[model samples]
Target: MSGSREWLCYTDGSAKPGTGAPGGWGFVVKPPSGSAGPAREGYGKATGTLAKIMEYRAVAEALEVLPERAQAVVFSDNQSLVESLEKKLESWRASGFRNVDPLVVESVRLIDRAMNDKELVVRFQWVRSHNGNPGNERADQLAAQGAREAKADLAVTTKRR
Candidate 1:
């Protein structure tokens, strides 16, 4: 809401088989500040034990890929993911991941990178999924795509990681 404008981001993360099987996560960035409505589409996936973290990492990585801007807000359907990324992560990390989700720890590192960037104003908001919101719908599509791709490649990456 400052000078010209900034980016409005929507992101989503998913785990295949409801957290058992490998899954993927993705995010869609809509830059309303510029003439183009969609700034970028980003997706990342990982299989095996780190499936959930991989999805969350995709969001943080997408932000890293965003164009330099003065302001931006990120929206997601996962409240715990948002809260863990924005806060609570530090305490969990300080405790040595004790009772902390590993994915949460990885997300913390990514969020920390953003924190150091002064020009960026990133806010994480929780939105209701499948609510008929276009942005969310788009994000969901991207996420699904990412997950499917990751699942297909899980066998290859599982042993490497």
Candidate 2:
């Protein structure tokens, strides 16, 4: 691993575009050198049937599990979520995050905790989806599985991604 900051996290979420259809979120955190114990993956179901919410949930869940004080980049297919994390955070926070999704609020809070409380450096970046990116693809699969199963296994990990 390169120093103590050896993590990159990719996240994605899925939801049927309809009311009450259920949503799923997933994330994969891996070391750049692939030398860590193993890539950690997390997936879970959400009650809302909105991809945006699921996307936010995925990031929130991801930030929750990251190693304390580690520098990492979080990549996502959802541009809005990525922007929210990077660009629009202060404006939203100044307004008390009014009208923001609860999931998003939690995510921003986690980001703050990671930086201020945990001494971590978290950066956000956008990624194009379905372009055969291994980390994103695996997260997509886990999100799909969560959606199909309608499960709530948040923050849990399996051996492989």
Candidate 3:
């Protein structure tokens, strides 16, 4: 990938308003040619997961699917996540993902995976949520869809067993 070209990804996560609810994450990647790559999403059954964890998971998922030699910038509405990825990730790794708070450590696996991809150049950018940004809005909608689907799936599973 040319250093001058960059792909953009917008990521978001959603869950029920209260804790211990199903959560979901989604990301939309736009390549340098101004066309969108596939939008990816997933729902998780894990209860009591923080929204921040979901947010990081969205970023991780996006990073995982990016082309190996691509230059990319990921946009997120979560400031802490942006800070952690860009600033604290190195220190967190130095401690082998132990010294960090358990919440931050939840994203360690994804973060480590991203770091290991030497050919992928990725950067994190913060965007205002619920703003007029089209990419962010779509990502948020996708996440909500994922959360709802997850809850419905869980309900169906419970009914069968």
Candidate 4:
């Protein structure tokens, strides 16, 4: 239960596009390697958000639950998200996050905060959506459910460590 840790994570986001559209995000965080514990999950739904922003939020929140210094491998179905996290983050920050979509900037700030403040090391990986990957599928299901929850006027649900 104590040592360098690794977490297998997955995330996905759903939205119909356009402003004020129902959007949602979900994430799964498996137990650290060599440990035995229930997987952690969370989902959030809201209007006026985009799928990309939702995806960023999903990863951000999921990363927040990992213990400090834990190594995280985060799998996502969104290429733009993966690229932004892995490649564009530094450049985006160099510009002070100016000229970026406000929501997206906010989401990225959360992600950076989660990583820096928590001292977590994260690796972003892009996975093909609906390719029969169980974690990806599960996250997708949760995201779809979140999107539907927007219709039911539900709030975000999460269990943090």
TM-score of each: 0.75, 0.80, 0.83, 0.85
Top-TM-score structure, candidate number: 4
| Candidate 1 Cα errors over 4 Å, as ranges | 1-4, 18-20, 34-37, 49-55, 86-100, 154-161
Model 4 per-residue lDDT at 63: 88
TM-score quality measure for candidate 2: 0.80
For residues 1-161, write the lDDT of model 2, one tens digit per residue.
24355578899989865434667889998865646578889998865567777787787777777777777888899988888779877677678777567746766666665666666677888999999999999999989987866633322322233
Model 1, residue 153: distance off in Å is 2.6
lDDT of 2 at 26: 94
Quantify all predictions' global Cα lDDT against the true fold: 0.68, 0.77, 0.75, 0.82
- The CA lDDT at 18 in model 3 is 53
lDDT for predicted candidate 3 compared with the true structure: 0.75
Please list the residue runs of candidate 3 whose C-alpha ends up more than 4 Å from where it truly belongs after superposition. Answer: 1-4, 18-20, 34-47, 157-161
The TM-score, computed over Cα atoms with residue i paired to residue i, of candidate 1 is 0.75
RMSD of each: 4.3, 6.9, 3.0, 6.3
Q: Tens-digit lDDT track for model 1 on 106-135?
A: 676666566556456666777898999787
Ranking by TM-score: 4, 3, 2, 1
Q: Alpha-carbon error at 80 in model 4, in Å? A: 1.2
lDDT of 3 at 43: 35
Model 2, runs deviating above 4 Å:
1-6, 99-103, 151-161
Better of 2 and 4 by lDDT: 4
